[model samples]
Target chain A: MNLIEILSYGFIQRALLAGTLIAVLCSVLGVFLVLRRLSLIGDGLAHVTFGSTAIALALQLYSAASLLVSLPVVLLASLGILKLTEKARLNGDAAIGIVSAVGISIGIMLASVGGGYNVDLLSYLFGNILSISYEEVIIAAGLFCVVMVLLWLFFHDLLAISFNEELARVSGVRTNLISAVLVMLTALSVVLAMKLVGIMLISSLLILPAVSALQLARSFRACIVLAALQGGCSVVAGIFVSFLTNLPTSAMIVMINLLFFCCSCGVRRLITIRNIG
Target chain B: MPVEIVATERLACGYREGYVLEDISFTVNAGDYVGIVGPNGSGKSTLVQALLGLVPISSGSARLFGSRCDNFSQWGRIGYLPQSLHLLNPIFPATVAETVALGLLSLKRFPRRLTRQDRETVETTLDVLGVYDIRSKLIGELSGGQQQRVLLARALVNDPELLILDEPTAALDPETRERFYHMIADVNRSRGVTVLLVTHDTGVIGQHASKMLYLDKRMLFYGGFDDFCHSPEMSSLFGEHSQHLMCHRH
Candidate 1:
């Protein structure tokens, strides 16, 4: 079908609207997470959502109602990750690993014991973005506004803490509160985004765009802007490409992000060579 | 009488394992340049961290500007440069000017937006530190000395009343280190800013500091430079020859 033909479908329209909003949210948050060395947090929280989704399905709550079960679980799991890093003196990766391992295992055990829910669970594992509902679109838009507004309100404070937590604290930025806000927002994003990108590939959405921006951007503000642009563009392009090629929409989005990252690296190298010669 | 900027009375602080600093008592008045000298792992950093409320105090009391250390909210009066410059990520995308502007954040309330006047303040501080030309350069791209100066400019941008530097010159070359010391001494002398500098370079810091606080987990010595030079206890602690080398250089 032609481009106009593809846009006519309601499912395609919902997918584009929801996917763009969530992609922007993940990409913007990814900049801070990458700088703070907590990039895996997206993946970790995605796994927690997996376990929580299993519980939700076992209870016969599907689609948007699953959020009623998954939201608080994933939020607490994010706080648990933070507490482990703080009190247990574990590095961020180790803390994430422990939480991620427990989450996936709990999901596996639930899927086995609960029985007859494997088909529904598989969709969450790999995602089906082209089938997004209108309610999920509104949910995505609401989450985008909440994350972006809080991010804008606390922009300088977030920048300060991401640069150096102790320095931020000394500057009276309330580092602990800012850090909690960041992770909790990520948890919210993860719960909302699992439907868009799936649990297995969610981290790529959170990491790839931000790393690409870091390669080419000169200032922090530029980095954030570049990441958001790449994220939103990738989702729209991936949706159109998936329609034309009959490929999976979620995986296509991730591949486009990787392509953008490679192009950014190439451009950065060319700039360095030009500066040198 | 001069106003007290910092005071610790029998202050004790430590981690989960054990106390690193105990029975530490001192009072720093306005414009006093106190050099905190000690051996490696002598809790020099801990003592300062305790006073700044970065670490919890186990017992006793520490105060800044007459308020309890933990409860002190007037961070605009204090500027601190931590010892771990190596902790800064090499790819951090902040410009020197942006980094210096962070120093003004303590004085701002929530939704802290940098005003045009804040930009001017950052510019003046950068010029004072001789880093104005590189204000637009990325912080990680600067050389070690330039990075140190940029961080120092960040510390001084707000024009704080009390400046606390923990081993600020640990990464500079001998010539660069000498220039940095002179720069800090100038800040103390010209601006009348109280300084609490932590360093292991006992000999070099003695020349600039008005008083010496020699610590080895506990207070080994605290007095005027002249008193520190002649004290029998310090002589015993450092040995006569070593004490003379540290004190006579002034």
Candidate 2:
């Protein structure tokens, strides 16, 4: 099919819009998470989403209804991760590891005991972005607004905590509350994004663009803008490229992000050499 | 009866590992320049953190501005510069101006957006600290001395009534360190900002501070520097020769 022919499909249009929106939220949040050394949080939460989705599937919840089960579970799981670090005195990675391990094991146990739901669960595991419904599109837009607006309102506080938690607390930034908000938002994003990038590849969407932007941006604002641009562009491009090449849409998006990251690294090296010269 | 800006009665604090501070009792009044001096592992940093409610008190009372430290909400009246400059991420991407602007955040409520007036305040603070010329430079790119000045400007930008610094000059050269002390003294003298400085530079801080608080996991001494010099307890603790050298240094 031609470019115009591919663009003509309603499902294709919905996929493109929702994918871009989800990608932007993940990328922007990823910047803060990466700086805080909580980048693995996306992956950890994605694993929890996987396990929760299995529960949802067993309960005969599918599509948007699945969110009814996964959303709250993942949100609580995110807080659990935070509490583990603070109260349990476990390091962030170790806490994430424990939560991630439990989540996946539960999912695996459900999948085996329940049997027959393998085909349905497989679609969620790998994603099926081209089949996105109109309601999912609207849900993606709402999620985008909610995350972005909260981020805007708490921008300086988030910046402060990400820079130095001790100093941010001294500034009366309400460090604990802000941290809870951050992780919960990440949980929400991870749950919504699983449809766009699949459970396994969701963390890549959160990490790659932010790391790429960090390589070259001179200011924090520029870093955020760069990460968002890369994220949105990767999604749009991946959709078209996958339609043309017959590759998996989610994998294509992640590959495009990797390509952008490589380009950023190269440009960074060139700028360094130019400055030296 | 000067107003009590900070009061801690028998305050103790610790981590899960063990207690770092104990039996710490002192009160700082308005406009007092108090130097908190201690040797390595002396819990000086922990004491300040406990006062700010960053570290939980194991027992005893810690209050700031008459409110319990745990309930103290008047952050706008206080500024703090922690000792962990090396702990800052090297590539944090915040400009000197942006970094200083964050100091004004303590004074703001929800939906805290910086106004044009706030920006001007940040600029004026940068100018006062002699960091105006490099306002646009990224913090990670600046030298240690420049970064220190930028951070100090951040601490002072809100025009806080009290400034708490923990080893604020650990990384500066001798000349820069001396200038930093004079600048702090100027703030205390001119603006009447209460000062609580933690440092190992007992001799230099003695020249600027009205009082001295010597700690070694406990309140070894808390009094006027003159009294500290004459106190038999300090003499026994430091040994007469070391005490004499510490007191006589200009």
> Which stretches of model 1 miss by more than 4 angstroms?
B248-250
Q: In candidate 2, residue B153 scores what lDDT?
A: 94
TM-score of chain B of each: 0.97, 0.97
RMSD of each: 1.4, 1.4
Candidate 2, B1-250: lDDT as tens digits: 8999999998889877878998989999999999998889999988998999888899999999999999888999999998756547987878889889889889999988999999999999999999999998788888888888889999999999999999999988999899999999999999999999999987876799999999999999899998989999889988999898878886
Clashing residue pairs found in predicted model 2: none
Q: What is the TM-score of each candidate against the true structure?
A: 0.97, 0.97
User: What is each candidate's fraction of native interface contacts (fnat)?
Assistant: 0.63, 0.66
Question: How far is B64's C-alpha from truth in model 2 (Å)?
Answer: 1.3
Candidate 2 wrongly placed segments (more than 4 Å)? B15-18
